[model samples]
Target chain A: MALQDKYAELLQTATTLGVGNLASTEQAGVLHVSGTANSTADYDALWALYAKIDPNMASGDLMMNIDIKADAGAQLKVTTDSSNLNIRSTPSTEGEIVGKAAHDEIVTLVEKTDDSWWKIKTADGEEGYAFAQYLSPL
Target chain B: MKLTKLLMVVVVSATMLFVSCKPKDADIKAAVEKALSADPSMSGTTVEVKDGVVTMGGECKDDACKAGCEKIAAGVKGVKSVVNNCTVAPPPPPPPASLSTTIDATKMQQVKDGLKDIAGVTVEFVGDKAVLKGEVTQANRMKIMQMLAAAKVLSDVSGLTDKK
Candidate 1:
């Protein structure tokens, strides 16, 4: 049987999980499955299904690049000492300050724009960019 | 020749002492089997004892069943320890109730009416779990979960927004 036909159920489960940026293609006789799972539970469920289909996963006929989406609410914390981290409107130090994330305050990560800046939201409804160095992902 | 004779006597005496100190494999095996048979969860598993080490090999309902077998073998007299190689098969999850491929129009309308602010959200039933997919802010996501929860439907919310 073809790789696609063999792992059809796995692909179907990924779709059912509502995975984002899903791309599946066959290359060199290996079915390449890639997607961003909305949560870790969703990612694990897909792997469990794959394991169920092939107990050993020794077919060497599948390549998976599924990743768990990191949107942990209030789990990420601001780790800067003493000084409050400025949550800016843009992902830059020069951007206007929309809010302040106090030292050690837990914030929700909106996204990491680059190596130096991250978009974050505080529990008090403050949302903007903060220096990535000050925010620790938990 | 005398030294060689002395060495042979010492070697034979050590072997005899070692053998005598260890419990017989048959006794340990019998005790392990008895304990296993007494437990309903581990009664079906096979037990083996060799030189005081007990080995269990068979299918078990879960990790607890596998551990129970190991515990039984460990508690057996003369058994040094247990090497539980029992394969644990997790219990099969309950079957999902049959769900319609198409979303019920009335139910969909009721959901939409309940959460008027959920713009562009697509709700569909995937094997008894409602999958909500669309672009929404963090606050909107929480509201959507509450609305879906009120409808008594298990849900998987996939955010189209970049934040999630």
Candidate 2:
């Protein structure tokens, strides 16, 4: 199913419910959302479990439906200049910049790596640990 | 035995090869849909890719839709390239047909210069007909249209119609 087709399907589903989106008058933005927490052991699993259906989210924004404080799954879209959010070669900040992000400026957090660090996407799409203070959506 | 070990190695490698080959068009299309659905950026478009050639056709809601679709299409595994036939919405009027070559060529120059700065707007004059290319954005495709309409009221070119 192409997204446009799926979007059409979703629009059809929305019309059946009488809700509409601000962007498209014929279509509705509201869709299903999982109101539960997902395990953070894996990145894909976490998103599959708790991603929200936001019809009008812009790049570099947070998933508005997920409250930061909610013990549930909150997926954050990185929307800034964090494509170069680097992790040092060693655990220490004094080390060299090992890798960089090759794609989207945003990254969703899967889990805390250690007391001071959280693993994030590196250049090759591999996950590496970064200091927790630099990560937000807390 | 030595033969058994060799057979086991060959079987495992072949299995890995089979699993990693480019999926069929149906499977690839399904994966593309799933991947786009999972991501928020690719929300309002339809895409079809066959044999590494992506055939994207649909009205994108905005420029973001165009850019987002292109970005996602670039990432699908085994995609050699894409043919972007996707149309963005809020479409601009089709260029006016040439009616005659008698309109003042200098006046057409002024109109062309005024509208070119506007993104996606193209202006061409054929006799009394002024063909506009590119649709409207936040800058207003109507701005030029309004100017032309008003100019007609003030000048001899008032006979200019968008339909040409």
Candidate 3:
């Protein structure tokens, strides 16, 4: 899809699924370069949104980046894992999910490399990248 | 000895008069500085005080700053009357890349929400028109007034002078 079309698609998804979790503001385009990939791959639309909002993040950094890129230390705590187990690439709904997370997953945040995105660990102690957008503070 | 004593008293009296009559204009300048420092919006506007007559001039970012300068001038202790000639200028905030046409409705909502996020403003938008209908601290009120004037919804905002 074209860049503008991609952004619009992401915007629509964010309006619906991101309801209370949606970001408070919008910003210009961003670029990405990371080595991580998603788990479930069901969150493609979400990753697209993230790319429009910010393009620099690697595929693995989606679930870990926050609204603003802070170098602060991160610690993740999983509060919920429902029917859908899709892992997204960016914080916004426009991003795509590259992987699937299991139920009752607890990911420990290791670092904050970009906007609200953090490095996390899965239930089986698998280290991966995620966006802070989906996780609540500990 | 008595002659010398008399000379001393005369000299002392002269000193007293000199101290008592020191320039109140300086006092007025200090007072203006004190008031402006306590308020941020008026920090940029310059105040010229001479012989207790204040002439204010500077380009503030908005009408609120202008009003703030005037109000501060009037309330200050040594001020006789303020000749507020302060000018209003736009902020250097970066221009929006593609001015996304925020709907009039969205404009009103953003105004209210934006004002609320910042302390000291109680903003309200009735219909498509936003009406800011309360008092904020003098400094904050000044800047807010300027924002209201520049606000897209309040493009035709008039009666700013009539309010005070």
Candidate 4:
């Protein structure tokens, strides 16, 4: 069976979940689907559904590029150079400054708003996105 | 000397027979109940001893508690076998939906981050209160409660399955 047809359930589920900017294509017997889920729960749900359909995710027949917002499961550390990092409300420098993280403070990465910005929350309950450059995986 | 030896043997044998023939139901029941009451798991259990056989019956919080009652019963003196009839209590129902519908998104997110790496647990805002559920140690539960309390958020913590 064609990979696209084989993965119709996943595509239908993504659409049903109201994923934004959804795109799908097939090439070389592989199906690639990309989209942005509004929340981490939605993204995780999609991954779970995918796993149910393809248990090991080993099929290589599909590629997923779903972006999850509000991703609190990731642990990261701030690596700013001798200065604290600002946690902004949005994924932009002009976004409201809701909190700040000291340099080298380990923070929970909540979301990858984009390549340039990451949403993080400190241990004290302050949450906002920081510049991606200053954040490092712990 | 030989007559004294015979008399000693008779006394020892009679004592042994008398001791063996004595019914130990009361002692066995007392010991089993003592053991059960000492264990927190067997809180609501009751034991009956009849002819060296034990019958345990009551409600336990879970299967482990039910099994613990049987083990305590079997270990009692003169208990030849245990007839376990304890029933495991069903898990309490989830909190009322009113408890979850009014959660503050920002505070809920904060609670989630504060409890990183703790498995099988979730916290959410319920109106002005934060409700915690799933597996969490008492120490961690108190810690989380303190953090939220300091945050000026009231919290109701329950459904804590203490880690084994």
Candidate 5:
């Protein structure tokens, strides 16, 4: 409950932003929150608020698992920090690098394979799984 | 004229007797509700009675509860029949696990892959915890945390310092 009090503003902001399936639970001294943000901007706003509330996020008392809402055939933007994002044969990086989607490129989502990986197809017809961390739903 | 007055009195008494013999719709509704209240699962059900016919409304936890409510209402005194209009509620979704405690090889590789692009940061898996030590910008720091969370990997970023 104390963790709930500490992050009340974050929870309020999430509700205000209309995050879908929002849920929160406190366990083992850490507050775990999971939901799907309506858009990438909303997701970024929540993370920004989290950082502000916990400076440098040093306390480690919260685990926010919010992700952007995207469905099959939805447009996704490649957000790699300059280099082309790797499209692998499988969800893990251990899989072969089958293709690549350039930074800031738009691709179509085939499916959300898992929390960390998504199967995507680029304009050039290259299709494979990529890290979801670098793909923002548009 | 006296015979005509006696005939009017007989007709009035007969009507009174017929009305008193049957229970009122309101009384039947109360009885049905009382019976339904015996089961906690039927708490959401609502009862309405018109002409001794009971109509069950609202949500029931499942089909069994809906049928049970209808049977209970039909058994009530003076209820001619029951119209079970109660809807069955969908089962609640399973709660999401708060954290993934296992640190399998795949999870460890995922942590390594997430850190590959970010320079100056190195990670070591100590027990189930991913201990990260290095300097990272504010944006990268957030990215690191999000990546770890997506992989469901518990981490120790206390050793990570802000890159000025």
Candidate 6:
């Protein structure tokens, strides 16, 4: 309840922003909140609020498992810093590098393999899994 | 004989007028429904009236809402009493524990893969925690934390420094 009180504003904001499947629970002194934000902007806003509330998020008392809402066939932008994003044969770095999408290039999402990886197809028709962190849904 | 007959007719007419003045069961039901509808939370409640007594059915979000519906129905005009048949909905189940305290091989590799693109950051597996040491910009710092959270990797970023 104390952790809930501490992150009440963050939870309230998430609800106000219409986050889908918003769920929160406290376990073993940590508050775990998970949901899907309607857009990347909403996701960023929630993260910003979280950082502001926790100050560099050093407390480690909250695990926000929110992700941006993106479906198959949605457009995603490569967010790597001036480097090409790797497309792998599988949803891991252990997978061979099958292709690459240049920084800031738009790609089509084929499926979300997991929270950490998404299967995406480049405009040239090359398709494979990529680290979801470097892809922002458009 | 004519006077007696006229008196009987007058008595019958008075009784009919009194009965008409009393509100009908259907009218009481409508009024109770209208009163409950004033509260959006009471939308799930259904109202019925018999002999001016209102019977509320359907689901309520909680006990407070159930009690509230009864109060509102009782306050309505022509309502003799209220029978709250509304049931409180059960709370949603809590989410499963997500943070994996122990670091396995796959989790370690995930941590490494997440940090591969971020320069200057190195990871060491110390017991269950991923001890991160290096300098990162604020934006990258957030990205690192988000990636770690997504992978459910417990981290000790205290060794990590802020890059100017």
Worst 10 residues of 5 chain A by lDDT: A21-30
Output the number of the TM-score-best candidate: 5
Expressed as tens digits, the lDDT of each residue in B48-70 for candidate 3 is: 88878998887777988788878
Tens digits of lDDT, candidate 2, A36-85: 12221222222322223212111101111111221213343332223445
CA displacement after TM-score superposition, residue B161 of candidate 3 (Å): 59
* Candidate 4 residue-wise lDDT, B1-164, digit = tens: 99999999999999999997775899888888888888887878888888889998888899999888898788877789999899899775332222222335554554565555356778766656566678766545434543443233445554445666
Off by over 4 Å in 5: B1-17, B58-64, B80-93
- iRMSD (Å), candidate 5: 1.9
Could you tell me the C-alpha RMSD of candidate 1 in Å?
15.0
Model 5 per-residue lDDT at B129: 77
Q: What is the C-alpha local distance difference test score of candidate 4?
A: 0.68
Q: What lDDT tens digits, residue by residue, belong to model 6 across residues B1-164? A: 99999999999999999888899999888888888888888899998888888989999998999999999889887889988899999876447336444678877887888988888999999876788889989998899889887776666778878887
Better of 1 and 6 by lDDT: 6
Looking at model 3, residue B164 earns an lDDT score of 31
Instruction: Say which prediction, candidate 2 or candidate 6, comes out ahead on TM-score.
Output: 6
Clashing pairs in 5: none
Going through the candidates in order, what is chain B's TM-score? 0.48, 0.42, 0.45, 0.53, 0.79, 0.55
Better of 3 and 6 by lDDT: 6
Residues A72-126 of candidate 6: C-alpha lDDT, one tens digit per residue = 9999999998999999999888899999999999999999997688999999999
Candidate 3 CAPRI-style tier: incorrect
DockQ-derived CAPRI band for the predicted complex in model 6: acceptable
Ranking by lDDT: 5, 6, 4, 1, 3, 2
**Which should have the higher lDDT, number 3 or number 5?**
5
- In model 6, what are the clashing residue pairs, if there are any? none
lDDT of 5 by residue, B1-164 (tens): 99999999999999999899799998888888889899999999999999988899999999999998998898887989888899999875334454644788888887888888999999998986789999999989999988877777777899999998
Candidate 1 similarity to native, TM-score: 0.31
By DockQ, is 5 or 6 better? 5
Q: What is the TM-score of chain A alone in each candidate?
A: 0.54, 0.33, 0.33, 0.55, 0.97, 0.97
